[model samples]
Target: MAQLTSIHRFPVKSCRGESVGSAVVEPWGLAGDRRWMVVDDAGAGITAREVNRLVLVHPEITDGGLRITAPDLPALEVPTPDPARQVPVAIWSSTLTAAAAGAEADAWISKALGVAARLVHLDDPTRRPTSPAFSEPGDLVSFADGYPVLLTTEESLAALNDVVLASADTGRDPLPMTRFRPNVVVSGVEPWAEDDWRRIRIGDAVFRAVKGCARCVLTTIDPDSAVREKEPIRSLAKIRRWDGATWFGINLVPDTYDVTIRVGDEFEVLEAVAPGSGPLRPAP
Candidate 1:
């Protein structure tokens, strides 16, 4: 039986995430996950992809809002922005009105990143919908790249690491699961078994495997050191490359909003599409 072994939530996009024993599955994703984000002067979403140091920023969800802390900077507690303070923000291709966290929060983030940046909050995740190509109608997501939940398997990580060690010597260390930043990690599954899963049930919640999470330069950024290196991305390209992208974990969209998932919860595959089918495609 496959059991969920880890639960993680990034209260702020591209920032360090928190591990929890349990998480509430809302319509968009885990509660408080990616509810806030760092944006450039133009109000476009920023991530570790460009500024690796962003991963060093840690956000703790507080009573009213968030308390963000980073090296060489004092912790800053920010209250939820008033809805009337909404600003137009763009995350990828989706543009939506997000509540601005105000100048105090923006200044703190700007100093921490050593770049002009602003902090914005997603007052309602439902304002942005998932790509219709991979999702059902009316499917919504938080400030995530696309899907709601990302799931990875321990066996797959081990297999990828073995490949990395066997491949060209880059002097890079074996990668940790954190490199993938998954919302849920499943143990006791065959390596890459999730590639074939179309529908799965965890506890009382059901989810549709929407798409394969394509690898990117962000995967090369070390979470702790804020340093970039040729890595898992290099190795993944050798084996998992398809359709011009390297694939790793799978993206999931839940069937409903009101489910609570725990680390020890058992998961069952209710349906599976054919192998070699695009990991993100709906089962025919």
Candidate 2:
């Protein structure tokens, strides 16, 4: 058994996340998780992976909507756009409908990052379905990359940091879990134990592990400093490279809704099976 050490909620995709003691589980994801997103003038999604300063944009959840704040910038309150007024937006290759937060928001965020960007809200959480390859029919998600929740274990991160510290090629500094931007962080588990989780229960919520999280260059960006560096990825390529990608953590879909998961909640694996591992190892 492992303990859920933290619950993070990212109101806006790829921006800074806030750690909460407890979060309400919605069918799409935790309440308010990634329901908002920044997009280019073409209505294509923009993330910190491309604009590092986006990590500095802090969206504080408000009664009516969001209060977006950033360093050396005046905060802006963005109200929820009318659900009836949705516009076409592109996420990856998918064209989805979302509510535009109006010109004020677009200008604020654009000026904040010194780029032309617009902010949009997921008017309906059920608008997007999870990838059919990994999810059952009727499963849905918000503006998140794919799955509803991303889970990472402290033990696995510790193991990766150990290898990173031993390497002379990397910065030799241990990375924080924030770099990965996981929604649920678990502790007190063996390194990479999540690899075998088929189904698990955390607190009152049950989840099915659908896919392993393939890391990208976004993990190399520091959320606090907005500085990009070669790290975890540098070490991950040595120990976690497989299928032509560096892997870490896992993606989960909830089996139930309205389940509140709190920090310090006890989690247990109900089912397990060895996952595919062609070249993955502790270290090369």
C-alpha lDDT of all candidate models, in order: 0.91, 0.89
Off by over 4 Å in 2: 168-172, 275-284
Best by lDDT: 1
Give the lDDT of residue 219 in candidate 2: 96
lDDT per residue (tens digit) for residues 76-178 in model 2: 9999998887888988756889999999999999998899999999988888999887888999989889889999999999999999889856355688999
> Which candidate comes out best when scored by TM-score?
1
Worst 10 residues of 2 by lDDT: 275-284
The digit string of per-residue lDDT tens for model 1 on 33-109 reads: 99999999899999999889999999999899999999999999999999889999999989998999999999999
Q: Please give the distance, in angstroms, between residue 55's alpha carbon in candidate 2 and its true position after superposition.
A: 0.7
Candidate 1 similarity to native, TM-score: 0.97
Q: At residue 120, what lDDT does model 2 achieve?
A: 96
State the displacement of the C-alpha of residue 52, model 2, in Å, after optimal TM-score superposition.
Answer: 1.1
